[model samples]
Target: MALFGLFRRKPHERQGFELYGAAVRAARHPLFFARYGVADTLDGRFDLIGLQVALLIRRLHRDPDPRGAALAQAVFDAMFADMDFNLREMGVGDMSIAKRVKNMWEAFHGRARAYEAPLEARDEAALAAALARNVWRGAVAEDAPAPRALAALAMATDDALAGQGLDALLRGQVTFPAPRDMP
Candidate 1:
């Protein structure tokens, strides 16, 4: 073996990856597009996954245990790692992939922060406005009810996650409320 391995690194924390997968699957539920009118385009899909991931990360941050912080970091690392791999698979050039991923990270960060205040205050109207702008790119009106429906689902999701124990999440389990069950 050569003195320097090409890319020796610690194995990813499986728990984070599994959790992210759950978030992705939840984001892909058909009702989001069929009923709520979220666009079925790439950007729409990305925003959906980012929203779900943000909610999970929000819940992760609430745990007082030291592991919560570490777990949250792992989730973020896993998400970007997967994004990098996906970009490479899609034939994005090495130079361009970094820039693209950076842009996505920034978008995700901004979207997460935008939801934080409204989510905290249970402001459905504000949450609908943010979702309408981000998920629909402002194509849908804030009072149109589609975004408000998503806001209701989001609120239910936040409540569902809040009810789950930290121990279950640490063990790589998360539960998002079923969209159909939401008003």
Candidate 2:
């Protein structure tokens, strides 16, 4: 039974991981790191991916379909799994990995909560402040473009996600607007 279970594979899990991968790819878009002034570092990458994942999960949270809830859980699981894998690849010691991952999870959740209200309100200034505080950790350049661009991107991404049908999202067909298209 155990062997069969291992081979059977959970389709939802696979789809969730695929969706997370798509979000990560979107986060890695070069324009953000280059033109938008996001730091080209591990923390910056994680913040971008975390922001994207939060947008998707927020959309799923509002969905009425039960499957949306399941998929949301799956997506969250896949995100943590990816974080664990990333930490391992960075050579974090096994004993410290758990603590590090826990901190990452907390950071992700904190940013998500901070983003929720501004995103829901479509308030660009608030979003910019949140991005500055959380994503940039108050270290953004004095004239950085990222805060404004990222705020616009987050709002645009939220709108895009909202337009996607629950069925389409479940099928791992989510799409985000290009950073260039946001403003």
Candidate 3:
């Protein structure tokens, strides 16, 4: 079996890399930072990426196909690996890097859970509150339109991902609706 490993053709991580790339592109869309008022800072970018990945994971979790779950985990591992590489590029010291990454990991989990229920319920108000707290770092007012607008986009994105086939998603293809079209 070990000898046959050298002949393996496919790069197993290709799909995960592609999917993570799509999520990053979607999270970086200008509308999110411009119209939605999500700051273009590092934290803002991280939160947006987390939200996008969480939605993708949610979609994958619903599929009866075990392949979807495996793909979802692969995407997740790819994200954290990128984070580790980014920290190194920024010159974060080795000791500090692990702590920072751990903090970010915890933050991502909390925010993902915060989004899950509201998105599942299609509860815009709840989702908006969560967005304001996480994306804006609680700097925005509860009644501000920014969070609400972002929440609308999130819901639409969720629905869009849900509609796409798992096979297509595995091919690194996913569609996100136009933010301008959302409420």
Candidate 4:
């Protein structure tokens, strides 16, 4: 069972931005990616997950319309890659931790709409909350990487949307500087 399995308590529904922010915060720990040297550089892999979360929020926040299932599959694949690299290369010296990560990956992959609407939102909120509760309490093993990869996957989808210029759709109104009259 996953560490949070013991609780068996469900969390309340939340806004997409709130969910994304929480996920980012949950995965923003240096000790996590720092372990395997995958994050040894100054690029700050520690915030990679958080960035991913932001990207996802930016996308979904911009576009309320549903995306094709293929997009979700691609995201799952990318997340699988990141999770593997993070655990195998940058994670602390712990096999169980790796197993847990693998379990999460499998579970996430097995899901159909990992990035779809209501289901996607549900997953993000649950993972973020669980990560926050665990990482804050140090419930996971030492040097054990946090489960930010999930959030990263969610964010990756947002990146695709942004690439398609869909960010403004969800971001709402923007104030651009007008040209000076003295031009």
Candidate 5:
């Protein structure tokens, strides 16, 4: 147990936390809520962060290097830690935090699966529908611009990430597309 405790804190953990923080910062871009019509509500914010993280995870999963896998796991751990902190900050009872975090993990997994196929196919229409259903929770107006715009943003984001090197990502550096570049 003593040896296990010593190995629990890996060096990559700090970098992962920083990278996850970068993802969160990108997701909080004001343009998403102000211009793109992504709600400023908690759920909307979480969905945006989930989208960004999912993109990073997808990129990591594609890399053949073992370091990519390690970093991916670290980033995932950081995200869950952040979620736990957020729940605590929101005054969730200690006993309920575990259940809430589990639910959040399930939600994130479902969103990732829903996004993967359309993103891989680069199917704009399918991406738009998925974004509408998940991001907007199907409350968006039929003529709303948010769905298409957000889908475009996803594609642009993927492209931007593709341009980034795995080393840079492992160093806790990532860049998301500008809102103006979408659509």
Candidate 6:
């Protein structure tokens, strides 16, 4: 019987968070990694994602202009909830890729807001170029659960994004390089 099938209680069936936790458990397989290159490290990626999203949620609650925060939260939620889809989309094979993606997002949010109000023509191309260095893909060795660099980078990104408004960040209108260019 599957591990999930062994659970007699249907707590997860009733609670969305519990269901999500079960999904997280299933995402740990190496076959999962082989099919979806990102999200190889369960704890680190989720922790950083949870932290960042918490901040986004709080910001959305506080912001008078909350559309950006809401959208960012939604995007993050979609990414985290579908571990396989996100990993496959990003072509990530280890934790470092997670970190790189997080850092890139944060850096874009952190420094991309020097443009005109309402973010018209915010020069995303330039901003993306600036953050291009933060991208990482498949840098972890086969034996490693996740790359140390990814953990560090994701933590750093979380710190950066915690204080910011997503709309202001997105309004700044920065473009991210294609995923393949991520280091």
TM-score winner = 5
Q: Which ten residues in a row have the lowest lDDT in candidate 1?
A: 3-12
lDDT of 3 at 91: 96
lDDT of 2 by residue, 99-177 (tens): 9999999999999999999998888888888899877888874235678888888898999899999888788888888
Collision pairs in model 6: 37-92, 38-92, 96-150, 124-174, 124-175, 135-183, 136-183
- Steric collisions counted per model: 0, 0, 0, 5, 0, 7
**Model 4, residue 54: C-alpha shift (Å):** 9.5
Scored by lDDT, model 1 comes in at 0.88
lDDT of each: 0.88, 0.87, 0.86, 0.40, 0.87, 0.38
lDDT of 1 at 162: 86
Inter-residue clash pairs, candidate 1? none
Candidate 2 stretches with Cα past 4 Å from truth are 1-11, 141-144, 181-183
Over 4 Å off, model 4 = 1-68, 90-100, 106-132, 138-183
Residue-level lDDT for 116 in candidate 5: 93
Q: What is the C-alpha RMSD of each candidate to the true structure, in Å?
A: 2.7, 2.3, 2.6, 16.0, 2.0, 15.0
- Clash list (residue pairs), candidate 5: none
Q: Candidate 5 lDDT, tens digit per residue, 49-121?
A: 9999998888888888888888888889999999999999999999999999999999999999999998999
Weakest ten-residue segment in model 3 by summed lDDT: 174-183
What TM-score quantifies how close candidate 2 is to the native fold? 0.91
The estimated TM-scores of all candidates read 0.91, 0.91, 0.90, 0.30, 0.93, 0.28
Error of 1 at 133 (Å): 0.6
